[model samples]
Target: MTRFPSQTPHGEISEVFSDVFFVTGSVDMMPGFRISRSMTILRDGDILTLISPVRLSEAGLKGLDVLGRVENIVKLGSYHLGAHNGLDNPFYVDRYGAKLWALAGMEHKGGLSTDHILKAGGDMPTRDLSLFVYESSKMPEAMFVLNREDGVVIAADSLQNWSEVDEFFSEAAANAMTKGGFIRPANIGPEWKRHCAPAPAEFEKVSKLPFRHLLPSHGTPLLNTAKTDLVQTFSHQFS
Candidate 1:
């Protein structure tokens, strides 16, 4: 089986913060839609933690080598585990309770397993990084917070920022996503709510967190005023 749908000649790695970088790749989800998968790299000293990993090409691997040695692989939820095939990483981690519920389904679907289960307030491989369980969504999802001078929240699938469809998107898919409320900037994922049945109170609690940058797996990163944007975007759902 193909590890990835397609590989870019060079992984498009962009620095989000001092020691944080992101790579974007394509995923074959909808026929006409150009769905994207993002991999977030958090570098601590000479060690790196890969979150929601995507398969990279030879040049991409070279790009990653410039960063640091990859020490750990993390899947924020079950839905983000598709591209983790054949990775010989040292450590792997998943959501705390996902093994109890998602492991069977993942095994049946030929997905990989985690070496460690992560929980909120638990220790991560990297220092100054913390995990939080998004209790609002029924699906087992975890969000990471980088406690730096400027706080950053690394989100999985719940919060998206698909401002506009890119060149990879088919016209039909773009239209469908826009109409389905999936292509908005800094908004809750429509399909996630439909499938996971999230509660607004959970997001209300999230809105109160002091995060300035929002790095989502699906869309562009909100560099500034991310908390305010999140509150304004989904506050109505809370009420």
Candidate 2:
């Protein structure tokens, strides 16, 4: 019985803003084809909420313990529900006795262990976080806006900022993603866009959200210029 998909290589947790931390990791898409992904952790007092989780090493877990207790594990996107790569929602739930908050329609994916259903205007992990659902996407997808630190967005697969292929990306994956248009800056997720086909109006509304920075699950964090950069993408994507 695999306690979790053999722990993959991931970076140490980094405090991007106050108690908001970020970590980078890789997901083996196939043999010799691994791509980079990320996770965001938010701490409010002694409680911590993990969004788009990635399994960490034993030392990394100790570092996480130093931050706070893992109280809530949130899954914002319906597509990546531990189905591919290392989402690690169930492992954290079993290990920490944490609640899993997942999108309403994702249960069919199996193995989700959904303790709470995530929906617009429903219960959130923290008061400072607000949910923004893509109401028209083929699959359930959403983002969170942290009310503090000039507003930081915690995104899943919809928004991305993969400016370049970093070390986490295997050369095979890098070349493949680059050809598929997955390697770009401040861009809509090419795979998500092609599969989900979310309506243009969804992004139109996203551009208006009061967020300055975006910490996406699939790319480098877009700081300060997130809104400005995304607005450009929306103009091109939705105009």
What would the TM-scores of all predictions be?
A: 0.82, 0.95
Candidate 2 yields a Cα-based lDDT of: 0.84
Residue by residue across 15-130, what tens digits does model 2's lDDT show? 89888999998888779988888999999898999998888988999999999999998888876523572257767877898888877866532265678887777889877888
* Number of the top TM-score candidate: 2
The parts of candidate 2 lying over 4 Å away from their true place are: 108-110
Total clashing pairs in model 1: 0
- The per-prediction CA RMSD against the true structure, in angstroms, equals 5.0, 1.7
For candidate 2, report its TM-score: 0.95
Name the 10 consecutive residues with the lowest summed lDDT in model 1: 95-104
Q: Which ten residues in a row have the lowest lDDT in candidate 2?
A: 78-87
Give the total clashing residue pairs for model 2: 0
Q: Residue by residue across 1-239, what tens digits does model 1's lDDT show?
A: 25324543224899988888987765555455456557788898877778766667767777787898776766666444234322322113221122221211222222445556677766576778777676655667767888885788887777777787765556777777789887888888777777777777778778767678888877778888788888888866555
